[model samples]
Target: MGEDRRKEIKYHLSEEKIDELLREAKDDRRKERLGFLKNLYYGDSIAEAADREGRSAATGGRWADAWNEGGLEGLMPSFGGGRPPKLDEDEQEQLVEMLREGQPWKSQEIRHLLKQEFDVEYHPDYLGKFLRELGLSYAKPRPKRPWRPENPEEILEERVDDALDEDDQPHNKRKGDDEEGWIVDDDICTDGGTVLGFFDASQPQPYDNSRRVWYVDDPHVERPLVKTEDSAVGFYAVNGTSVVQWKETEEKEQICEVLEAVREQNPGKRILLVLDKHGSHICEYTRKRAHQLGIDLVFLPSGSPHLNPIEQVWKYLKWTMAPIIVENEDEFHELVKDVFDQVTQRVSFAKSWCEKFLDFQKFP
Candidate 1:
């Protein structure tokens, strides 16, 4: 380190002016600059003043030069010498409008569009940041189709009532007589014998999953390509509080096996298995097996995967596995197993997913 040799020179300011500058400084950097000037005006050496302000002697020397050249105005921060923005005002406006139109776009697609339309190049990673600067944010694309029930609210209410009826208990007892009847309480229901399980299947591919990421535009940077040669279908069952079971398979026989295992696990409890109306789930053989195991296979309304809470688990699994680049089928299976283990360990996390995403409440 070199010492500042301008100790003989002095910078002067009126006491009232110093106080005014200190009071007017709105940020820490401005306050630091004012303090540096105050120390110099009170006969402190540049090195001592710089040390007091937690700055190096060379930095103090530059500030002293700025003070001599343009007074306090020179001490104001100046940001310069960076590459200019790739998108101009009009292009940014166009981009914002495009995003507001709600067309799902990947970062690479946006980057290619920018290059093709405006002759500007941005790295895939930096493009997200640039979009954020324009008040746009990246998000996972949700599947939306025009097919829906005419009375969705009624359907939802029916489903809730059906679930409650499956577990309803009588609050009032009847007298000991052959003709006596017990009163069933509509408001009171128990979850003890009823297990609410959501089921879904996902085929995780090797392609990088598109997700929300902070993007900026820089052409020189290169993002690593995620590649894989193997893929597998996952069958998962969650009861909101925890993952009851999961398996890797596409065969419908596996679904029967899962139901059987759940039956064995809960003994006499009735399994209310909520799942989408996939053909396999509604097939004769699958229904027979579920019936034998005392599992009520309740299907969601058509085109309504969002109604099932296990869909969130599938999304979480995909998000967890997105960054991993599996070399082969074995590695992919192992990674999936590891991620499943991590998720199943946190019971509260599973419960929250059920409550928040599926509106499935847990009973004590």
Candidate 2:
């Protein structure tokens, strides 16, 4: 009769319900028990299911008994029994406050501090678990310098007003239109020029590259070492449509050459050359030459690369070219040129890059 009772023991649940329970089970032990039950539902005997799940038949029978008594809740792994926390509520609060100060602290330092201040001790391995239980986490500390600007919102509003005022009196207004206080209504192309270009320079090194690949868990993934001896500086301009022109060199002369090429490309239109306050861009000779070539040099605010859209172009270029391997200086230069050519050929892409800075009102 006892053997018959053991053999007859069964709990029925719909396949859909069983699947839902399996999906909802968070712990692996619970999932394994659920798998055992699933095998039973599909006609496997208790012992057979237990063997498949690497558990004893008695253990499997106990799970079935629990399920019969309490349904899905019976399979849950209980967390009711564990060692009590060493730190009380007050001590935990103190630790949290100390961590919130953003000071650089390692587990060793924290452990020592706990011992010295609170008379508490925790094993190095268990410290992380203890912190997690208190809803605390380990993180890299970010350092920040004090920065207080006076009525920054008001300052920004005033700057916006100034830009709008400047916009009302467009830089390239027709002579009679300027006298008559007339404004061009079009935003597509300023009366000044159709092509709005942002200019910057970047150096592409041979060793700067990255790619994805699969690796085993035990061994750390490694990248091939490449010579970093050779690199090339590139001066580039993107009007947010296409690359107007790019020159290779770290020489200030290349800056002038790019400006001249832009001017020659768009013969009659005035080129508004937005660039950073690099020494090359700010030199008197460069400014004088720009003016002579019908180029208007608009310097971005100091330390504010966000204002220059060209920075995005340079970033995109570098990221796209990072995976290419180059063996020599010549190969490095050729790769840079090839990537730039590919980027500039996409007119729509270039235009989109310049879209954020298209609003003259956003400029300071």
Candidate 3:
């Protein structure tokens, strides 16, 4: 008989009731009713109820005892004061603002600030509890110099890039086992017999073959590229094909001609040309040539360079070539071409092209 009673208790709460409670408890009042209903319908032990409420068995037991002793009146909480606020309203607001701004303030920092400014010294544990109440947590970040000038440009960049590129990863699709396995190339083809080259190493294991892949959990490769150019007048394409063209120079005309050549090279291939929606790249002639070459020109959303493999190549080229001192444009062009030649020789660049096209097929 005792075993039978235990078995009945085990299956007391119907699965439907549990699901109904989960669905219906959208607000505090409904949650309270669900809690009470769970206790009533499930016939859970007073000790179990005590554990659920983080209270003593005596208190939990008393609720049932009260209901038995005086009916519905026993279930209500006595007009007892609720737990005191861990932080005042002002402190919570301040902490939330600081956290929103990516402030790396420690709990001790908050405590110290409170003590110094407001003459309130909260216990360290209590300070953490206060932060938790405000949905804040202690996180150590890179140090910032107190006296450093605030870079509005950096702040705007942060606003635009941080949301999408928080992980500082290069290639999101690359697998964990993928080392320095990919190669990238940047060759600028001009109509007038000119090719400017750019180069970057490739990440390995480009295809994510792992069965346990997750977008949030997976570590991304850190391809060094700026999401946005600092200057207003610059060149960008959907994939890291970015350059600050010398406005009104022969170089700009040459670049435009090279793009035209790219279209000419692949006459019938349904080319998906990804360009950064820069003003120069969006000129009337470029658009006309795109149609003429039968190129499906896709403009990338602003401030998203990670989507482009070419930009990664550009970043790699700049890093590698920064050491070389160029005397003039011709020298720069020669060094760039040499870098391009060196990069195209590697297999990673080909793999990147393959992976990039594959990704596009899936998403687009």
Cα RMSD for predicted model 3: 18.0
Q: What is the C-alpha RMSD of each candidate to the true structure, in Å?
A: 16.0, 15.2, 18.0
Candidate 1 vs candidate 2, lDDT winner: 1
- The regions of model 2 sitting more than 4 angstroms off are 1-83, 129-194, 207-209, 212-251, 266-274, 291-312, 322-331, 344-364
TM-score for each of the candidates: 0.44, 0.50, 0.37
Better of 2 and 3 by TM-score: 2
Cα miss at 116, model 3 (Å)?
Answer: 8.6
lDDT of all predictions: 0.59, 0.59, 0.43
If the candidates were sorted by their lDDT against the true structure, best first, what order would they fall in?
1, 2, 3
Give per-residue CA lDDT, model 1, range 138-199, as digits (tens). 68877665676766545754654555454433211123422333332233233356665666
User: Which candidate achieves the best TM-score against the true structure?
Assistant: 2
Query: In model 1, what are the clashing residue pairs, if there are any?
Result: 126-215, 126-216, 126-217, 127-216, 128-215, 129-215, 129-216
Q: Any idea how many clashes model 3 has?
A: 20
What stretches of model 3 exceed 4 Å from their correct place?
Answer: 1-255, 326-328, 344-364
Per-residue lDDT of model 2, residues 96-205, tens digit only: 66765745678888899889988989999999987654445567865432342434334433433443344434433324332432322122233444455667776556
